[model samples]
Target: MNLTDATLILLLAERIHGTDEGVREAAKSVVKKIPRGKRDLIYNVINSPSPLELVRHVAQNLDT
Candidate 1:
């Protein structure tokens, strides 16, 4: 993924922590603008996040 998208996904992945206000706000802002087809990645990251898993999902979505 490109830098902007990668950055957005990384912040969104931080949502798994729940208590990080900055990350949550940044993620919320970007996630709302994410295309409908790719919203599931946000759910996956929040539910079962890992750096590798986030990268994998982001890369997979980039490919689409």
Candidate 2:
């Protein structure tokens, strides 16, 4: 299925907090592939009030 960038970003951020190291690494790989132009979106997610600490960490580290 073709996921929108926002959806993919949320999912990947969650996966980055997964217990499985491989899954976390794979999520990080995809996150880094996001266009730098999406940095604003990533920051928005990072700053959202309800976002988990791990999710915020992942979003903050996005190369986008």
Candidate 3:
């Protein structure tokens, strides 16, 4: 996935699991790799999805 999509996934995982220093750092790393202007887009995508869906999606992805 692109940086924006990756950031959204990380952010969603973090939100579902609650904030953690590691997760925040990881998300920051992803954001840093992208253009500053795109940060909001990542944030918007992360916040747009439901937490349950995020968790379920992650779990499903992992099972594969």
Candidate 4:
């Protein structure tokens, strides 16, 4: 995925957990590119499941 989408995913992951400083920084780098209205969407996508589940979900989507 592109940097914007990747950043969103990283943000989502970081929000779910307190670790992953690198991912958080990456998310910060692209945070401005994300639209304000879409914050909830990113949160929802990230918080919908556990991190492992989220990883699997992303992997599944990418497989298609």
List runs of model 4 lying over 4 Å from the truth: 1-4, 7-19, 41-64
lDDT score, residue 38, model 4?
53
lDDT of 4 by residue, 1-64 (tens): 4545864566466556645444444444554566776555345444454444444455467537
The weakest ten consecutive residues by lDDT in model 1 span 17-26
Candidate 3 lDDT tens digits, 2-40: 754764667565666664444444555565667766677
Candidate No. with top lDDT: 3
CA lDDT, every model vs. true structure: 0.52, 0.50, 0.54, 0.51
Better of 2 and 3 by lDDT: 3
Looking at candidate 4, the ten consecutive residues that score lowest on lDDT are 41-50
TM-scores for all predictions: 0.38, 0.33, 0.37, 0.37
Off by over 4 Å in 1: 1-19, 43-64
lDDT of 2 by residue, 1-64 (tens): 1225654656565666544343344344444556666555444444455445445565577677
Report the error of model 4 at residue 15, Å: 17
State the lDDT of candidate 1 residue by residue for 7-39, as single tens digits.
555645555543444444445556557776666
Better of 1 and 4 by TM-score: 1
Clashing pairs in 2: none
Task: Provide the clashing-pair count of each candidate structure.
Answer: 0, 0, 0, 0
